[model samples]
Target: MKRSLGTQLRHLIELLDGAVGAAYEEAGLTYRPRYTPVMRALMQNEPATIGHIATAAGITQPAATQTIALMVKQGLVTTEAGVPDGRQKLIRLSPQGRELLPKLQQCWQATAAAAASLEAECALSSTIEAAIEALAARPYGERIRAARAVMVDSGKS
Candidate 1:
């Protein structure tokens, strides 16, 4: 029998990240797998606020903030208050981060190629895309709640 959906998805992430993280370490890069989206956002739009970063990265503002904070600690990025609204933090890549871009870009290209090959072999890219679209239309939480209601009404809960 197959494991739970969430568990399987999480395990997949662990496996993928483990391999990707190893690659980063082998390259002598102090980057984390979780930081890719934020880094890409910053690469394209430097000196951007946390809100903008969050939007570009398709992640929550809090997650962007935490990632930025970690990057700052690692001397990979810097943060300053935004103009007009000093409360907003604007993030920029540090000199060290800038220096690592070429190598990171190479790594990114390799990773992309590997992912494309894996998708071609597995044929799951479309399925995953559709799943994302479906969930966007109706969240998993809503489905779960509806199922639970059915079970309760049927005296099976």
Candidate 2:
């Protein structure tokens, strides 16, 4: 039996995230890998809107919002209503978060080195990038719907 592509992708994430989580734990840092993109975005710019963070992090706005909420609860970030637009929220790193930045940046550097080592051993990064580009042109949902039509037409569904 062979694993499905989705299963393989998920397993890969689990393996990588688990190891990274362990590294953070050993470093005595309380952090989540999901927070990395948000942190990076905020580090680059303060008083950022959710949309800005989303674009900077290459993540959806909902994900950025959720991560920001969690970070706020952990006292890692502060959010306030935008001065120009009361409805829009601006986010910035809290003092605690800034204090942790140096250590987090070091961990990120180490993680990148480890990831590069893995990339040297495998074509993982390039393949994922290509897949992302291909999917951007024709999304997976569209592909699935086309395949489903074929299955229905052939009475294979």
Best by TM-score: 2
Q: Per-residue alpha-carbon lDDT of model 1 for 1-157, expressed as tens digits?
A: 8899999999989989998989899898878988889889999998999999999999999999899889899998998888897988889999988898898988899889989999989977898899999999999999999999998999963
Give the CA lDDT, 0 to 100, for residue 31 in model 1. 87
Return the lDDT, model 1, position 56.
Answer: 99
Candidate with best lDDT: 2
What C-alpha lDDT do the candidate models reach, one value each?
0.90, 0.94
lDDT of 2 by residue, 1-157 (tens): 9999999999999999999988888889999999999999998988799999999999999999999999999999999999776899999999999999998988999999999999999978999999999999999999999999998999963
Worst 10 contiguous positions by lDDT, candidate 1 = 148-157
- Consecutive 10-residue window with the lowest summed lDDT within model 2: 148-157
The parts of candidate 2 lying over 4 Å away from their true place are none
lDDT of 2: 0.94
